[model samples]
Target chain A: MSFINYASREINLKIVYYGPGLCGKTTNLQYIYQRTAPEAKGKMISLATETERTLFFDFLPLSLGEIKGFKTRFHLYTVPGQVFYDASRKLILKGVDGVVFVADSQADRLDANVESLENLRDNLEEYGYQLEKLPYVIQYNKRDLPNVTPVEELSRLLNPGKVPEFSACAPKGEGVFDTLKAVAKLMLISLKKNEK
Target chain B: MLGSQSSLVLFDEEFSNITSILEKLLVEANAKALFLVDKDGQLISSTGETDQMDTTSLASLTAGNIAATGGLAKLLGEKEFSVLFHEGEKDNLHLSLVASRVILVVIFDQRSSLGLVRLRVRKWNEELEKIFNSLEKKAKEKGAGNQSFFAEITDEDIDNLFR
Candidate 1:
């Protein structure tokens, strides 16, 4: 859920990076946080368990220049990917504006991917949202892994609708911003705003 | 000037409209679930497809998190605790305070982006401020006694869960 504040002439948007455990959601944000220009980004906050898994969530506030006169600011969030944290997951998706799904490309984790998507749907329903219609993108991450699934196969299963998909090796910074740009474009399309 | 009785009507209307706006948001964000609960964590409205959402525990946890974080923020002299994000090894939780009247909770897949979630929260906050202001104004007009159009929640409703 994003607001175009006419008073301040600013458009604030919230985007959450979501996926299963160890699926590279946190890595993607870390990559972006490191690569982003200091003037355009904020501190990357990660609240995690002792094991370093995101305990609750992570946040990165960013500025994406201006469209017309409104400064389009984006807030980035990542949820703990562990399954038992289902309660925390529900708490995070309250008033979301856009989403980027980072699907793990490992063949054995296929079931995890599917189950995560199901959880996403169930949680969205709980919040009075429908999964099919949101401004979303899919990134088949960890493509560098030897046991990764074929991109085509992953695409068909994860993003059958063909809503923009990216092949990513997040740790190396491959396809990170490309995924972000695609989702941001999708978000702008939903608002009928010209992309800045 | 509109008197008090009419203000309550405005508040209810604003809340109703915000729910519709939220429905569009759930779709836009591709969220798995979303919730708008009051400070007490009572469910006011939800838009996405929640299959077995336990609003009871959802409200309780959300309020607890906000209170806890709010306390931490004040301790750190941050002035306000606007939002809290939890990224786990498997799933993630994003919680943002909705104009102090309510809390917005969202659950999403690892495929979603934090920036998008925060952007939407700002947008939701913009609209929510208006809704709360209208409702507050309506309450002022009506003498501020009982303004909630949603439910007849008691103090026990909030205290029972903690006990």
Candidate 2:
């Protein structure tokens, strides 16, 4: 949910990064956290298990400068990508303003990507949010790997809505900001339309 | 998710009232700080000595903790846990649900006992509930008017953000 506090002159939006396990969701967040200026970001918190897999989520609060006198803040969160963590994933999607589907582009993970996308749809439906109506984007991540699927094939399979999609190698930070910017822009535009 | 999209629209008047109520809770509970967070982890209002604490991360973690507890409660045939407490060597945290949508988190130190914090929180909960109930009602009644405030914002206003 996008909380617009006119009293505080602040506009806060929640964006979630969701994908299958080891799909570079955490890597995307780490890269953004590292690149963001000190004044523009807050402490990144990750609740992970002993093996460093995201157990609950990873949270990063960012300031995207100001828009029309309102301080625009984006709270970025990444869900535990492991399939058994469906309960945790549903909880994190409660008040999401937008979602960045970080689809693993490795040729072998096609089925996992499709399953995760279906899961996203089911979860959003539970919250009364339609993927078609919500601000959504897709990132075909792990593009640097040799066993990657072609962008065209990935788009045909995962980008059914044809939302703003990006090719990213998150560990190297490629397309990280591009993906963020695209989703953030879509979210703001959606917020504006909702006001009417 | 609540019935409608759970976005908090805080006007100055309501915000002031909420802060005053929070201030009263801080004094009555003898706590170091108090934070009002949405169930979805947005920090709505904060009071007291929070200079050293990172309330943003705290809010998100606290919400996640509460959500996990709520899930456990369901498995045990309960509606919700409603309250959670974490006691540390020096600082302790008391978290309670308010109006089913917002959470009240109190961080206190050795100076305050659990009994006092609980007592104060019990008394204040009713008052906070009443306040939020009315706020929700007002939001629904004047939702169109409230939304009008944002109607003036243009695409350029949002697009220029990247620049």
Candidate 3:
């Protein structure tokens, strides 16, 4: 849920980055953290395992350019990508302002991507949110990998709804902010529509 | 808006001092919003406009989120977690445990850099530890002196359990 603090002239929104294991969701965040301006971010907190599996979520707070004189603040979060972490995933999605479904665009990981997508929809439903109506997007990630699947095929299988998709190689920093901008804009749109 | 209830000092000197210090850090960092919540997930105070943020739910859920994640980490035979982060397209949230009693939340924009944030948190957290200890000492004194203050918090505390 986005909080509009008229007293402070600011709005705070929560966004969750989600995907299957090893799909570059964490990498996507690390890259953004590295590239953001010195004044626009806070500590990048990651709850990960010894082997690097996301335990809880990775958090990074950022400020988008202000809109209408109100500083637009975005609180970014990522769910554990492993399948057994479903309960934790649902918990993190609570009151989420937006979602970026980071699909691992690899032949072997197609099932993982689809399963994660389905889980996203189910979790959203449980939270009384319509997947089609929420502020959401898809990023076919790890595009630079040698065995990556075609973007069209990845979108067909994962993003059948076709909500603002991007082809990204998170490690090399390609298309990361583009995806961020698209989702931020969509989240703002959702907030505006909610106002009316 | 809160009335008929005995005023309780949730932050005490520790909470207030930390809050003021945190506010400066957030502003210097150009963060959008920030807050300090206790281990039980009760919101103590907030800097930055949280009218839309719902620090209430965030506090409860964040404590839950931290607890659940800590539990998972233990199950997997790992150590306890002191920090949590979430990165999305346009926003990010950082949850850092302060002196194991309070959790600090920092929300900022993509326009700011993460390296700077990490640097400041590392410094601010140390100061917070000392201040929290000082508040702890104050609480002990409060308990020894008035006693009613402690009793009041006890009543409120037990009242909260039933609630």
Candidate 4:
């Protein structure tokens, strides 16, 4: 959820990146953290297992810029994509303003993508949020891999609602900013719509 | 709009009110620092000894800790875990849930005792709850009306930020 603090002249928005295990949700956050200017980004925190799998979630805070006299800060989080971490994922989605479903584009992970998307919808529904109505986007990650599905096929399967979808290789930062900017733009537009 | 939207809109008046309460709590509790963080990990307000600290990271981690503990509680057939504490070599942390929407975190050292911090927190929790209740009502009314700041914000204003 977006928090507009008029006292501090700042607006805070929460955005969560979610996908199946090893779908590169954490990689997407690390790419953003590595590229963001030191002054613009806060320390990134990862609650992960000993083997580096996300045990809980990952957090990154980015200060974009000022908008209408209020500093705009985006708090980016990534839920643990492992299926057993359903409870943790639901906690992370409690107050989300936007979501980016980072689908692993590998042909073999199609079922994983579908299952994770369903889990995302169910978790959001528990919080009274409709995935169809929220400011959401999709990223087809691992696109540089050989076994990846075509963008068209991925879209046909994952982007049924036709939210802004991007092709990304998160580790190398390909299409990272584009995906971020698109969802951030949609969130800002949604804010304006909410005021109406 | 505020009634349905999960977003939190803090106007100047309520913000000051919350800040003052925090400041008072810090002095009364004799703590090193205190922070008010929402359940979603957003830092709402904080005071004392925070300049040298990374409050953003602290707030996010604190919320994560609370969520994890709350999950543990549900498995044990409890509704929620309202308080959490961490003792360290040099400092201690006292965390409590306020209004079921935000977390109140107090950090203290050898100079303060847990008894004092708990006493002050218990007394101020009610006042904080009242202010937040009023804040919700005010935000709902203003959001339903037309005085919203976003009302004056054109798409250009929003686009300009990214540029």
lDDT for each residue of candidate 2 in A29-93, tens digit (9 for 90 to 100): 99999999999999999999999999989999999888778899999999999999999998888
Model 1: CA > 4 A from native: A193-196, B1-64, B67-131, B135-163
Better of 1 and 3 by TM-score: 3
Task: For candidate 4, write residues B40-122 as lDDT tens digits.
Answer: 89999999999999999999999999988988998999988898999999999999998887899999999999999999999
- The 0-to-1 C-alpha lDDT of every candidate, in the order given, reads 0.71, 0.90, 0.73, 0.90
Docking quality tier of candidate 3? incorrect
TM-scores, one per candidate: 0.59, 0.97, 0.60, 0.97
lDDT of 2 at A43: 99
Go through the candidates in order and give each one's DockQ.
0.03, 0.71, 0.03, 0.62
How much lDDT does candidate 2 score? 0.90
Better of 1 and 4 by lDDT: 4
* Per-residue alpha-carbon lDDT of candidate 4 for residues A1-196, written as tens digits (9 for 90 to 100): 7888878898898999999999999999999999999999999999999999999999999999887788999999999999998999989987899999999999999999999999999998887889999999999999999988999999999888899999999999998888998888889888878888
For TM-score, the strongest prediction is 2
- Expressed as tens digits, the lDDT of each residue in B1-163 for candidate 2 is 4558857777787788889999999999999999999888988899999999898998898889898998889889998999899999999999999988889999999889999999999999988888778887877777798566577777787778777
lDDT by residue (A72-144, candidate 3, tens digit) is 6777888899989887877777667789999998889999998888999998887677778878999998887
Model with the higher DockQ, candidate 1 or 4: 4
